[model samples]
Target: MSHTKLIRMTVDRTVEAEPGVGPDIEAWRRSVAGVLAKSRRVSPDELGERPEDLLAIRTEDGVTIRPLYTSADDVPEQPLPGQFPFTRGGDPLRDVNRGWSVMARFGVNERDPEAVNESILAALESGTSALWLAVGGDNLPVEAIDRALKGVLLDLAPLTLDAGDQAGAAANAVLALLDARAREGDGVTDRSRVSIGLGAAPLTTLFANNYSPLGDTAKLRSVDLPGAVRLAATAVNREETIRALMVDATVFHDAGSSDAQEIGAACAAGVEYVEAMLEAGLSIDHALGQIEFRFAATDDQFQSTAKFRAARQVWARVADVLGARDAGAAPQHAVTSSAMMTQRDPWVNMLRTTVAAFGAGVGGADTVTVLPFDAALPAGALGVADSFSQRIARNTQLLLIEESNLGRVLDPAGGSWYVEKLTSDLAHAAWAVLQSIDGAGGFSATVESGWLCGKIEEVRAHRETEISRRKIKLTGVNEFPDSAEKPLPVGPDGTVPDRLAAGRVFRYAEPFEKLRNRSDLHLADNGSRPTVFLAPLGPLAEHNIRTTFIANLLGSGGIEAVNPGAVESSGLADAARQSGTRVAVICGTDKRYAQEAPDAVRALREAGMTSVMLAGPQSAYPDENTDVSPDAYLGAGIDAVAALAELLDTLGVR
Candidate 1:
């Protein structure tokens, strides 16, 4: 059958289609309601007015994702790609066959300039189209720029720099190199073909450094802000394609800001830079052209896609307000989030980065950078990504673009009801956040006054709470943990580097990783992980559900759960003793719990069990069985981190 006919047949099978008539959406909804009612064992009337919300999900950004969407859903009229506001895309005639620029990030270790050069050459020779070089402070020395770019073709591959506090020196070195390449007439016939990003982000620097020198005008001016702007003006005068500044919202994202907050903060920072450049004697168009916006692409695919679209819409509004409506489409670069990478089971990061890259591509990012999976590991002094990891990172983009053909359509997510509505909602929400920031004396002022950090902290606290309750699952760290997995190689001292930068880094799995670290130390000292005795009160059919539940929960904290078959209350004490652990958990069905839990708890306690937990909720016990209480309940929605920490302490694991 033809592909079109097969798709039509599939849709026909999904909906209730009358013979010789079209498929009916109302019939489809009725069928769905019937299925839900039968599965839930309730009358169809009991299903609330909005049955879609039954499967709806609420995001951390306060956006609700409904179960289904149709044309009836309310959303603003969307224009074609490359239209005004540029929400669909920045270019109407984008080459569908040519995908986004695959950018590779290399942290230039001053101690190993040769290694950095080798990696850069390999990346460019492979599939990478651009280079994001971290230079200056704690990276490659500014003077070593020449050696780093020794064999690179400056005109072909784009170059971006990350130089904190040394933007002037770094820009000069790069510009000088480009000049020499042009003077030598070696492959650089046109300077406009060469793209360079100076990466001078003053607002990001202030946030990372805790708003240092705030309220001191002289000290603030003494920073590299003026020099960065002047360098950008020089690039414009020389007719070179160099974006001298960046509005990097990844700083806010790593600090745990929500999606709306990241977009709003980025827009505010862009406005701040525009005003500064205008004050430095540059036109609005030149200022906008000299700046690019960077955002974090996360594992949440739909949200990440919507975030980029919403960011473009909101930024266009900002530019229009500044009297630059014709040049409102902001250049965007998306990088996989560093905060989402986990040290334990770091291999899963590959899946996360793939999804993030897909979202960034569909969201119309100009460039995407996938950080290596092992970038968070402490293998070397600087944790440099191995060549294998870098190869995988670049190949991920290649597969998505070449094999999957993900870049063959412009605004692939456009015209979908759900994506359109989400884009509009996110745009409005982010605009509100930007308005608040502007009202509070703008981005820099908010950061200096601690307003931005305070708001981000509130969201972080809530997110952490959800993570502790397992509402937000970290696949390897907090869910399906492998206590027996071999540890990844570490540094010479076998220590993970302290990545805390002014308390701005907030890794979602850090709390659970800390508990695991303690467990590792105990195992190193005692030759066994902390053990928990799981007492099943009945046959496998009666207790297997809770048995698996409690076992996985305990394993998340690096604690082993030992099940010695089904033990009667009389044998509970002996089984506990055989396990050689002071902590125990009772696992059984509700009916079994009401019949035998009290005796089981009594037996374990009399045999000197220090702490006994039940694998169900406290309300599962009958009202009259007040004696059926375990010390703690290990069920859903409980704070797993706190409970595991307490169990480790009680068992002398620390």
Candidate 2:
């Protein structure tokens, strides 16, 4: 062949003219058209006038996220990680080398220092070397302090204290503990091996909370007591390693912040703590080295991971403000919330724990505590549940670090569009909140004004609603029903006894003596019914609204819906006609009414659809004369699964 002919042939073989959007898009377009055709042919209700036009992406704080974010997404200029304003991250290795901490938390009472030591050792053995000791101010017994110190690697110091008044008894108790640690040693090597768990000063507490700076009794609880403990963590073997004592995320998670809020709040709190300590005669370096952090982990992986990253960013920024931007970067610890635990189906807790653990690991939490499944119940009855929970937590990290090698990628989400966007959004939102707190005077003022509580309660309400609607599934409680479950055992205290309290001996007391056997306490369990019917009003292929609606609903209820293929009005009728449907749900865009809704409804009604329903907008009202009026509407007021659940309730299924 001629040279030109050969060149043409080669070009043709190597690259053809651009294919018109590929067969997949064509197929999808055809499928969507088919769905619309069916809807127009069979359903009238589906063609309702109101249509879902705009997609609003708003945060819980009412902050709207743009569809696209660019470098311009940041305001006041986006600084590089480890640089000033540290939004990306404070350390040079933000997402590349340095990672978060995996610290363990221990309640210190020290009745049996040996047992406490054992617990500490157990945590360390599990690969978490850092610790947080919960102490009761002056009320903390010497035994608990001794116990807290017993088994911990000398490098692991804890933030030890309870929420209580800081003066008098609490102050005295904290002082005693600190005095003990101080007496243990003083020189470099001795102090190097020691750690402090001091109370926040009354002023520090007030300032941190945005209070009126009053010396009031209740407001004085979080103050710094005399003789605080200090120790170094092996985060990176240097200030650059991003490993040191951290502030617990639980404080904020428990305080009611969203994942973003938690990140910002923890960072702000850390900054406040460090600043307070510095003014009190401690060096910026010591303050950074001494302070640590924690956060609550949940099933939302991206959100959780972003939370950890945001935390580091905020801490880095704060340190920069104080001219100690290069100081030791403490780790962030994570714990699954007891507040989210449920008694309905304890087994589901394992799944929740697993997802949360995964997020913690990916998010770079130095230490994570997976609340046992039976944690919602008395510990003894936890039985196999705790084993699974522990397994999930441990194996999750192991798999990530060893198998997946996720640990090899520090700041794994540094460059991802979603993560970076989320990080920026969270940092900005949290910074705004922090500024508001500052404007109110500080942490003390916010606490006094009940502003802090208000912030938390908002998230709490959302969580409760999600839990109730099964939007965020809790296996036994919201999804699977355990008919055989027994009534949870009540402790002498009136509420359900802590599962942790039953089987294990108190560190302050006996030598591994078993506590009360409360396994007899179980929630009432009924046999499970796995059957579920998915009701979609429009044609399977054509009625293109909420395609994932049924699937999402079923998944949340622990039941997977089976679609009967892409059908239109006739197909829908046929489905309701042949399937043993316990419930029927109608799904379509409101605009479907203008097309094929009337016929679809008639077919469904004709097919003996007893449980006919519409998945309409919560705020929309049905026209008084609409022939496709459903027996019930699922959405808004009642989510899809919730509607099914109501039907189930009628059938005595739950």
Candidate 3:
């Protein structure tokens, strides 16, 4: 036998702080002011007129991120993990061993039960610790659940079902399968260790179906909210580890709700579920225990981390108010946001998902699911993640857990001034939203009165405006787009299949992708992409920056920018004619534009150019009636989507 070498390390906890021994808050504030003053003096332009405003960033959720946070900030006294209010995490020792569970999601198909089983077994044999099966409604048929899970050991793998309207039927199917497995004694150990999430989300379903409780009360009642609550009670009585309801906030998030809105909406939904369960005769603690939460983990690392933390605090507060203080902490499952996924340049999605997974793990999610990078691709069917994509998704979490050891430290983000302040701010904002929802008569009432949907629409409009103005840059879609990339396969009708047939889902990149699709169709018909001639007024050095900017902007909409090198003002017309494109954009420095852009614009117009565009702002010309006047101005902060669509129309791409 070989002796193992055990290395011992020491830690120091000797310096204990008394009440009087701490950092000087007033001195720190003075130092911060002095630093800001120095920065304004040294780099006035960088700081702008209001240096303070430059330091703070306001999120879409209306949460302000300060430039610097210190112990001087008004942060609440944070309790340890597993304590009441459980802001840090639900479980104190959650990070000690395996950390968060790596969950693999599969789209079930009744037509191919054997294939689905093979995929399931492959995921289990790999690094996936849990399974989230999309069942019913174009997914696995309720009756086919047993066949779909043929080889899977029920007691070993934790299962979550996303059955849409068929949640009760799917739950019964799973329960039947579990009963069969128990009777067979198929390596079944403790039933208490077997976790099953029934996924009965009536509010989310109603929202997805766009059913107005006021106008469509029959449809609302048809959702069988009471049935879902009763099922949860039944599941709780059957097994301790079975969570019968899920407050899935991604439904609101995908519709463009902000972080606080998503959290508040989720909490409101949780309260609704708890109330329904109580009406169904389940105790408060049992009702709370039977509910799990699902949130969308975005690429915003700090915000995503703070969101999960704040969500816990908000839910704990709600439960405490409901007299279930001890059962406040519930399991949270984090899935990377599909809204952030890009159809163009899909490889970049891997980076996005990686960051999302990291944030979720650090934020203390009980289970993390990384959707495949190509999840946004038109895979011709719903829930269709190829084996290669599945492997990458599975390994993404494994590498984070096994190699990076991201979860070894408990509350890794705890004690940091920035995280603490952000968490506190988010908690307060989300709780306010929940209170508003309650005042509006809870989740169903808000949905019926259109108050909740109206709020979501307002945020969606803001997000779209920001995206169009390039304030919210989507890397592969609206920023550095790959126009030459080949298109992914679509359905037979040439349209991308809708993942959610009934619900509305918004992808940040959809507008740009639409333009790209039009460009692709044009390329297929004309043997070349819709081309825009770049008419540079000065030398390469002077025009390169603006030319590069214009080219990137054009490429984002799949338009080809044809640069015929540096040309004189006289040659602008010839260049436009030679390029054989009616649209011509003059690119040069502001100084150069003032010198030669008038003649250049006149030349392109006289050459029969339908649209003459300037790369710089309209103020560069100062006089709109002069020969320098372009049909449109293409510059920073211009609506890129509208500009590109106009250019495509002018070029006759459609």
Candidate 4:
């Protein structure tokens, strides 16, 4: 459980109010003002120039997180558990008591049916309660579904498929497998425990491939209604628990959609499916019952939990709008974000996946698949079952469920003002987006029109900017990188990633990864990696901070920083010469720069340094006529990728 009192922003003030609480609202305001005045050491009105501005912070989705929430905030009417709107949760008790299903992706290599069987069996034998088999292309061969699931007790574990273009074939293969493997003599198979979720996500295909699954973008706008209806009717006839339609947000979320964007996309997609199922003649309840939602559970615990909660609540509103009352209770499936997993310092991924699983479980996912830490690695790169990372990933889910006992609490994030407000805020934002999609003629129309990808690209562009500017921190790649650790040989020749062929993939660390690859290749070819000389302008005290800043910045791109200890301005050229580095970074305080940088930069450029960088804001240095202004500035918001790329190009590392 969480201790909210520690985090809640409260005031320390006492005032006697009317016994019936008349005018207590004013008293509360006074209390807040008193606290602010004391903290800011200012008058109540001024409060540090603009005190009200500090009360809220804006998110990527344009929702403001306020410092306080009270009855005055005008929140939308929240519903009871299992009731209309379902803001509290879809079900009264969501995945509590028993926890979420511990599912694994169960990657298979060699396109061999036997290899698939080994992977599934090993995962199941080691605490996995469900399977997420990603078939088609480089993943599990679609033809090997039966062989992969061979010997698996259908009564024990549920199976979900991410077969991309082959969803229909994979769904049929699952049904056939259950028919042949889970039965005896002439009686039907007891498949109540066999939860078969088929990703009938045409929108996913459209966004991922721009309509390669279907004939063209025009066909993508038209859902295969007959196929979906047939699958729903089959589930109804087989007397099995099969969710025929999947509203998967994992693809979009990993593609750099914001929390509200992913939730809105899934809700809108689910709405499209509901329309199809209803058109197929199933009742609203059954049509909704056949649908399940899948989203990415990331390491941002609060956002992950809030996103899951928002997904359920927003979809409930959509269902309500569609006249499916009980349909609000959607089954949520969460897999940790594969894009967040890093190839460098892969060991830290255990922490990432574990927290994500916790958030998914707490957020009310029915099933949570913790992808292996080396999930970024292609299968067989580290041998069968993805080596020890797979085992650790399984144990991560197990420990959270069994030892940590996260499932014992019902709606653990409920009741907190922060979480409740965020949940409601996300729902409203996501519903507006869903309405926009509906206004644009649903997922199919929007995707076919390319408007959907445009929204995603907009978000992706912002995210890429932040990532390159280091405004968004990636632990091992851009912050505290471990140079001693061996890099994971996890890609296609350490360059082109094969995952884009598998699904809609986007990674923030791709630029740095490419830089690392170049660095590795450079080292292999020249017997030494690219080096940049840090020419400090004074004693260590005068330049230590800038020196460290520049080194860490350059180090992020796998560039070796050659620090010729803090030297006089006169020795700057000699230091660059002695280090034999083609690039030099000037590090000093602004005052020191004003006094020494112009001469030092001139000398270094004269010494044949092709590219010169200054370690401060671009405005920190005055314009000079001596041609000593830095070629580039390495500061807080500068693009790390562009900076590193320029340095590498100058050093001839390409």
Candidate topping TM-score = 1
Distance from true location, Cα of 431 in model 1, Å: 0.8
Off-target runs (Cα >4 Å) in candidate 1 are 1-44, 74-77, 211-223, 380-385, 487-495, 498-503
lDDT winner between 2 and 4, please give it.
4
Tens-place lDDT per residue, model 3, 475-500, is 97889888778855433333454333
The count of residue-pair clashes in candidate 2 stands at 93
Model 4 CA deviation exceeding 4 Å by range: 1-56, 67-81, 93-97, 110-115, 134-151, 163-173, 176-194, 211-223, 379-385, 485-503, 623-627
As for lDDT, the candidate ahead, 2 or 3, is: 3
lDDT score at residue 456, model 2, on the 0-100 scale: 66
Steric clash pairs (candidate 4)? none
The window of 10 residues in a row where model 2 has the poorest summed lDDT is 508-517
User: What number of backbone clashes does candidate 4 have, counting pairs of residues 3 or more apart or in separate chains?
Assistant: 0
Give me the overall lDDT of model 4.
0.76
On residues 229-298, what C-alpha lDDT tens digit does candidate 2 reach at each position?
Answer: 2222222232122223335445555444676666655665666666656666667776786676657787
lDDT per residue for candidate 1 within 343-450, as digits (tens), equals: 777789899999999999999898999988876665442345467777999999999998999989878898779988888889988999999999999988998899
lDDT of 2 at 434: 71
Off by over 4 Å in 3: 1-50, 74-77, 187-189, 211-223, 380-385, 488-495, 498-503, 624-627
